[model samples]
Each structure stands twice: as structure tokens, then as C-alpha cells.
Target: MAESRSETLRVAWHGGDRFEIQIRGHSVRVDEPKDFGGSDTGPTATELFVGSLAACVADCAERYLHRCQLPAGVTVTARYDLGLQPARLSKVALDVEAPGLPEGLRESFTAVIRHCPVHNTLFRAPEVTFHVLTSGHEAVCHHP
Candidate 1:
């Protein structure tokens, strides 16, 4: 095994149900639709979460095709089911289409794409901790 690496994403509220995310010098926004009391400015956080998985699968498939000198035409569609009680995602389904790929490599292709990081993470959950800060200090400084 190798040493683990960490990355950070910064998110700030941008009024209402909207938030701005900053990652590696790029900015993305997340919000709810108008029906959910949001301005419909961007995709909701749940959408982004599933999008990451789909994108990872697509990228992995494309890389495998390229490595084998095959024509690249990969598409991944993802659908998720939300669960109640705790308001969490319960299941995710992915449909991957790799047109023009040879028939013999179908199983291999599936195996490779299944190893995508986002998909593997779902199998082994990560630990999370929350911290609250006030003013410029650690949960103590007060603001006026």
C-alpha cells in the first residue's frame, strides 16, 4: 500500500440555498431548484455527487479503450435512489456504453471501469468529522 493523499474543497454560502465550491482554482456552484426554495442557479449537491461517479466511470472506460488502441466512444449514465428516515442515498445504478469496442473485451472493460475510485469508495465508506469555527478562532471567538 502507498501513503494516502488528501485534497481540500472550500464551500461558502452564496445566499439562499446556493453554495459556491472552490477546488484546485476552479469554481462550481450548487443549489436547489426553484420548487425547493432555491433560485435554480446550478445543480444540487446530490447531482454533483452522482456526477462524480459517472464521470469517473467514463474516464476509466475511455482510458482502457485508448490503451488497447480501440476507438473511444464511452458514455455513462447514473441514477440514484434516495432513502427516507435519514435522507440519504440508498442505491446507485450506472449504465455504461462503449460503442465500437470489440466483443471479446466486454468483460475486461467492465472489470476495469468497476475499479474507478468513486465507485470503489462506495464499497468502503470514509470517515468524516465536523468542526465549527467562530470569527478567526476555533469555535470560541465571537462576532459582533
Candidate 2:
């Protein structure tokens, strides 16, 4: 049997081009840079996207190394480029730095990153749809 879980996040406009994001019990801010008429208080959507990918890969790499009995620190940095014409992601470049990685574990670490959730997700893109509520009934929230 396979098991799965759901993830949900909420965001509300915070005046100007800033938004308040709620994930679990934490609050984060998302906004555009000052040159784009924003307060530049936090990372923009593009930054979050690339940042998530790096974080995901780093986490998986670290876990895989430790499981091999060679625990080491991992750092991942991703650079993104904007595609023209339609304005989409053109390319993503990632640098994985593991200063303490064992000599024989390079191949295994590379393989582990290949299966990183975020990296795999990019390999097989998921469906993304937009919905707008022109008119709808008031919804109630219930929490425990």
C-alpha cells in the first residue's frame, strides 16, 4: 500500500506588491524588489522557486551520505535564467558543495541528488491550473 500526505499554504496580500505566506504555523513574506515597485522585504516568487530546489537537493544529499555512514554537510546553490517569448524558466544551474564528502561517495551522492523530490519534480513537470471565483458561497473554516 502507498501512503501520501497533503500540503497546503495560504497567502494574503500585504499592501503594495508584498504578500504574507502561511505554512504550517510559520509566517513568511514574499515580495518584489524595490526596482519593481516593491518593498524588497523578502524573496520574490522566482527566488522561492529556485531556493526550494536547492534546499531539497541539499537535504537529500546529506541524508544519503549519512545513511552510508559518512555524515557530511552539504550546500546547494541554484541559478535560474528566464526564458524569452513566453517568460518561463530557461535553465537552472545547481552547485552542490560537500567539503567533507568521502572520495568514494561522489557517484552515490550524485545519484542521490538525481532522486531529490524537487529535482525529480522538474524532470516530470506537474499540472498547474489557475482558478478564479467570480461568485461563490461563503466558506467556513474548521480547525482542531
Candidate 3:
């Protein structure tokens, strides 16, 4: 039998291009166009995407180090290349810096990065499904 996976995140939009994101039942506010936004102030959507990738990797690294009972400190800096003609995410580069860690632990941490969910998901190009409901009508869109 396969192991079960379950988690839920909810997002609701407030007035004026502001949104509330609920992750595992906790609420966070996010907005766009910094000049007239809340919570994150003025972080663009694309910036947030890159931030998520870095955060995901860092989270996994931290967990792996803790599990191995190794003292490690990791910091990741991610840069995105968005200079394509059609305006798509061209490349993502990450700089991982670890200080005060055992020698072998660094190699093990590198392995953990390969298995990080965000890294795996990005490489797989998983399908996305969108649902729209308006005026008692519903529409679904699937991308493969």
C-alpha cells in the first residue's frame, strides 16, 4: 500500500488586489504592487515564487540535519533569470552556504537537496488544474 499524503491551504482575496493565505490553518496576508499592498508590502508574484523555492530547500535541509543529529547552519540565496523573449522563467540558480558543519554532513545535505519536494516538482513539470465558478456556472481547466 502507498503512504497517504494530506494537507490543505486556502487563499481568499480581499479588496484591492490583496489576499489572505491560510496554511495549515494559520493566516497570512499578501499583496502586490508594494505601494498599495499589505503584509509583504510590495513583493511581486515572481519574487515570491523564487522565495518559495529557496524556503523549501532550506526547510528540507534543516529537517535533514536535525534528523541526522548534526549541527549545521544553512543559508540559501536564489536568483532567477527571466530574460527570455517570451517572458518565462529561464533559469534558477541557488547558492548554498553552510558554516560550522561536519565535513561529511555537507555531502549528505547535498543529497537531501536533490530530494526536496520543490526541486523534484519543478523538474517534473506536474500538471495543474484550475476551477472557476461564476454565476452558478463552473468551468475547469487542465494543463498537461
Candidate 4:
């Protein structure tokens, strides 16, 4: 780890539609439900997005609380409303509960959530560029 560094994450298939994700020093697994051709071994893609937002906010709040010398008790529950017409994510609501926090710092906590990178990014349309690579079958893999 170093100051002002850029990092890249990697994700590869483990087995049976379950993916192995390498991030920082952690290995995460993402899988589909049994009905969707998976054994329900891990969280699905939709769950991952909800979980990421919750976890990111919690991480930000935790740092702020630590700086304020507050006791550690932070919880974030994320709920999503799916739209059927386009099979899209309609809305995501987060219920943050911090029992050990002081009332005086409540405003700052709201600001922290507003300023959280993940939170802000979710509201904006991302510029996603797709790149396709072609090979001559020289390097073939069973993995997707």
C-alpha cells in the first residue's frame, strides 16, 4: 500500500457461475441463485450493488466516527425497488442506524453520507466504455 496509488481489481470464475474477486487483500465470491443456474453459494450481482453501497457508507461513517472519538456502532440497511417494465433498479433506500453516536454530530453524518463517493456515483450516469478483444484461439480457457 502506498500514498496516492491506483489499484486494479480482478474477477475470475471459481465454479458453477460463482466468481472469485480479488480486491486489496480480500477474496470475494459472487454467485447466482439456484433458480438462476447457481447453487446459491454467494450473493448475486444485485445484492452486490446494494451491499457495496451500504458497506461504502458504513466505511465512510466509521472513519468520521473514529475521528470524533465515537463508540463503534454503525449499521446500514439497503433496500431496493425493482422496476418490471425495463427490468431495472428503480430506487434504493438506505436506513442508517448509529445508536452510540452523539446527537451533535448528526448533521455531519448526513453530510458524510451525501459526500460519500459511492453514494454520489450511484446517482450519476456513469461513462462506461466497452472494449472487445479478439484472439486466434491460441489462448483458450474454460473460464468465462
Cα displacement (angstroms), candidate 1, residue 43, comes to: 0.4
Full-model lDDT for every candidate: 0.93, 0.87, 0.77, 0.84
Give the clashing residue pairs of candidate 1, or none. Answer: none
RMSD per prediction, one decimal?
4.1, 6.7, 4.4, 4.6
lDDT of 1: 0.93
RMSD of 2: 6.7
Question: How well does each candidate superpose onto the true structure, as a TM-score?
Answer: 0.89, 0.86, 0.74, 0.80
> Per-residue alpha-carbon lDDT of model 4 for 34-121, expressed as tens digits?
9989978889878898898899899888888898888887899999987887787799998988887889889988899777767888
Clashes of each: 0, 0, 1, 0
- Model 1, span 60-103: residue lDDT tens: 99999999999998999998999998898899899999997899
Is 2 or 4 the stronger prediction by TM-score? 2
Candidate 3 regions exceeding 4 Å error are 34-42, 83-86, 137-144
Error of 4 at 49 (Å): 1.2
Residue pairs with backbone overlap in model 3: 34-42
- Model 4 lDDT vs. the true structure? 0.84
Choose the strongest candidate by lDDT: 1
